[model samples]
Target chain A: LAKTTQPISMDSYEGQEVNITCSHNNIATNDYITWYQQFPSQGPRFIIQGYKTKVTNEVASLFIPADRKSSTLSLPRVSLSDTAVYYCLVAVNAGGTSYGKLTFGQGTILTVHP
Target chain B: DVKVTQSSRYLVKRTGEKVFLECVQDMDHENMFWYRQDPGLGLRLIYFSYDVKMKEKGDIPEGYSVSREKKERFSLILESASTNQTSMYLCASSSSGTSVRNEQFFGPGTRLTVL
Candidate 1:
């Protein structure tokens, strides 16, 4: 499993765009980058996922450089409701030796202030 | 919308008691998983079932067991509840497909406190 490192917490104002970067220097060739957003007392929700380059969706965008060593999650027009803990994960399969284990880190806590 | 529902939002139990956490998904996904989340530690998988009557132990599965009698439901069982088992339990479901594109849908969660 690839260990990911990200900021413990961040602060952003409403209407601003927030980008949270995750470093996974040991990312494998088959590993896919995924981002999940978790609100207080609620389960985490899938935001976006990408293998390489940039993938944009209605909710957020995922940017993965060529090296695949790092990736960024971009949230547009943040609001107070967007304040949550964002988790960056390297998705792996449950088959084979690794199985389907999603190892989560402390995650980046984004505080959106109005 | 994919919806996963847990039987309880909060539960209180005593030590040395048996406990059961139920999870149901409307999507009829083939795979179901149980995980526990704690502050700073993040989410840890306890058990996962790929099909009915088939299960695999995840990273942390010592004190937990699971059951998958039907395709839409998965249950997590604690043989003897302990205070250390207190945490937010999460149930997730996903369909087996291409590894790169599959995403797991999570339930609201069940906060369990063993006193």
Candidate 2:
């Protein structure tokens, strides 16, 4: 299991691009970087994921360096609704037969102000 | 989209009582998980099941147990409810294939209060 470290909290204004970075020095070779957004009183929702380099989707973009020791989640055009706790996870599965037990750290709370 | 449903949105239980929390997924996923979320602790895994009649303890499994009698249903049980056991219980399911990206789909969550 890899341990991810991220900022405790961050604040951004509307229409701004927010980038949250996570450090996982001990990430395993089979680990994949994943990000999740959790609003108040709700379960965490998958935002984006990446194995290496960069992966972008309609929701957000994931940037993983060649070393794979760190990753960043970029949100384009933030809004008040984007205010939530963002979690960075290094997912490692033993095999297809088992559940990929995700170890979640204290996530970064993003507050988007208008 | 995968849908994971929990039995209750909110629940209240007394100390020394036996409590059961149920979870069901419509996606016929092979893996089901039980997690408890706290303020600073984030989400801690309580138990998980890979297949029917199979279970495994998670990071914080001291006072919690789980059951998976059927493929789509997984249950978490608290033998003796305590105040510390009161928290947000979440159920998640994920397919066995990496084709779905191996991401866990979580339920809305159950807020349990022990008196």
Candidate 3:
């Protein structure tokens, strides 16, 4: 498991793009970077995942550089409803290993203001 | 859609009483996990089961135990509840295969209050 470090909190307004970066200096080659979003009182949901380069989904995009030391999660045209705690996790998701055991670090809380 | 359901949304228990938090996943994922979340501290894994009757201790397994009697069900047990043991418990599941890209589906969470 690769330990992750991210901001404690961030503030953004409606329609503004929010980019949360997570650094895992000790990330292993087999480790994959994943981002999850958690609303109040609800469990976290997977946002986006990427090993390198860029990957986009309906909700967000993930950009990983060649070094793989850090990755960024980009949210486009943010709304107030997007305010939530964002968790950046790095795990070795190889099957039969520890796929379900995700070590979640203190996530970055994004507070979107109107 | 993968649906992970916890047995309760809220639970209250007395000190020293036994508590059980149940989780069931509909996707028949091969791996199931138990995690507790706190205010400042992030989610901490207590236990995980990859197969039937197979379990592994996670980072914070001191005051918790788990059971996987069947493929879709995983249970977290607190033999003696304490005040400090009160927190939000979450369950998650994922499929099997070769890939570090598999994502986990999480339940709504069970908030246990020990008084």
TM-score leader: 3
lDDT of 2: 0.85
CA lDDT of every candidate: 0.86, 0.85, 0.86
User: Which pairs clash in the backbone of model 3?
Assistant: none
Which lDDT value does model 3 have at A108? Answer: 89
Candidate 1 global Cα RMSD: 2.4
Please give, for residues B1-115, the per-residue lDDT of candidate 1 as tens digits. Answer: 7799999999999998999999999998998889898877777889988899999888899888999999999999999999999999999998974253568889999999999
Deviation from native of the Cα of residue B1 in model 3, angstroms? 3.2
Native contacts retained, all candidates in order: 0.52, 0.39, 0.57
Error of 3 at A7 (Å): 1.1
Regions of candidate 2 where Cα sits further than 4 Å from its true position: A92-101, B97-100
Candidate 3: tens digits of C-alpha lDDT, residues A60-88? 99999999888999999999999999988
User: What's the C-alpha lDDT at position B113 in model 3?
Assistant: 98
Model 2: number of clashes?
Answer: 0
**Which pairs of residues clash in candidate 1, taking residues 3 or more apart in a chain or in different chains?**
A93-A99, A94-A99, A94-A100
lDDT of 2 by residue, B1-20 (tens): 67999999999999999999
Candidate 3 CAPRI grade = medium
What is the fraction of true interface contacts found in candidate 1? 0.52
